[model samples]
Target: MNTYQHDWHTSEGYDGGLHHCRKCKRSHQGPRLEAHDCPVSDAEHHAVAWLGHAGLYRTRFDAVRNFEQSVTPVSVDELFELASKQILSQINEGCQRG
Candidate 1:
């Protein structure tokens, strides 16, 4: 796993504003000031990890067609769960086959 120091200001885009962290020489905006001026931990970065989980196909046309015809909603959570179950089932099937 790649590791980097929590440089919130640089990570958040260095804007010259009041919320900028002088120590880190960076800036923040909106409600970000309320939180600590450090990047979130890897384990806590669920959104990034969730992006890798496949769900709906590309294009709105395909998505609509799938939804209308196949009844497959583009739900990320559902897709992740389905993929996980398929993987586990495949592993179990392989074990049985062996």
Candidate 2:
């Protein structure tokens, strides 16, 4: 729920750490925190950035497909937008609480 943590891990391709932006969930490497420019200003941006990663896109697509089966189906973009808005809201709420 709390998405403030900038998740960092050792990169296999490099000696520095890889940082995952909490808002956009995009990975960054060899960049200082101050230099990293996260492009997640809204839900749409968050969805696009998050789904831009191949692994996350496939996994989220499967999950969204199942979700659609339980309710009215929507376009791929709309589905992702809805899901992204929900996630962004939760992150904001958690940030406020913390």
Q: Which stretches of candidate 2 lie over 4 Å from their true place?
A: 1-71
Itemize residue pairs with steric clashes in candidate 1. none
lDDT of 1 at 10: 32
Lowest summed lDDT over 10 consecutive residues: which window, candidate 1? 44-53
Q: Please report, in order, the local distance difference test score of every candidate based on alpha carbons.
A: 0.47, 0.51
Q: In terms of TM-score, which candidate is strongest?
A: 1
Q: How does each model score on TM-score? A: 0.33, 0.28
Write the residue-wise lDDT of candidate 1 on 1-98 in tens digits: 33324434434434543355533445556434544434533233322222222344544355455553432333456557867998999999999999
lDDT of 2 at 51: 34
Shift in Å, residue 32, candidate 2: 63
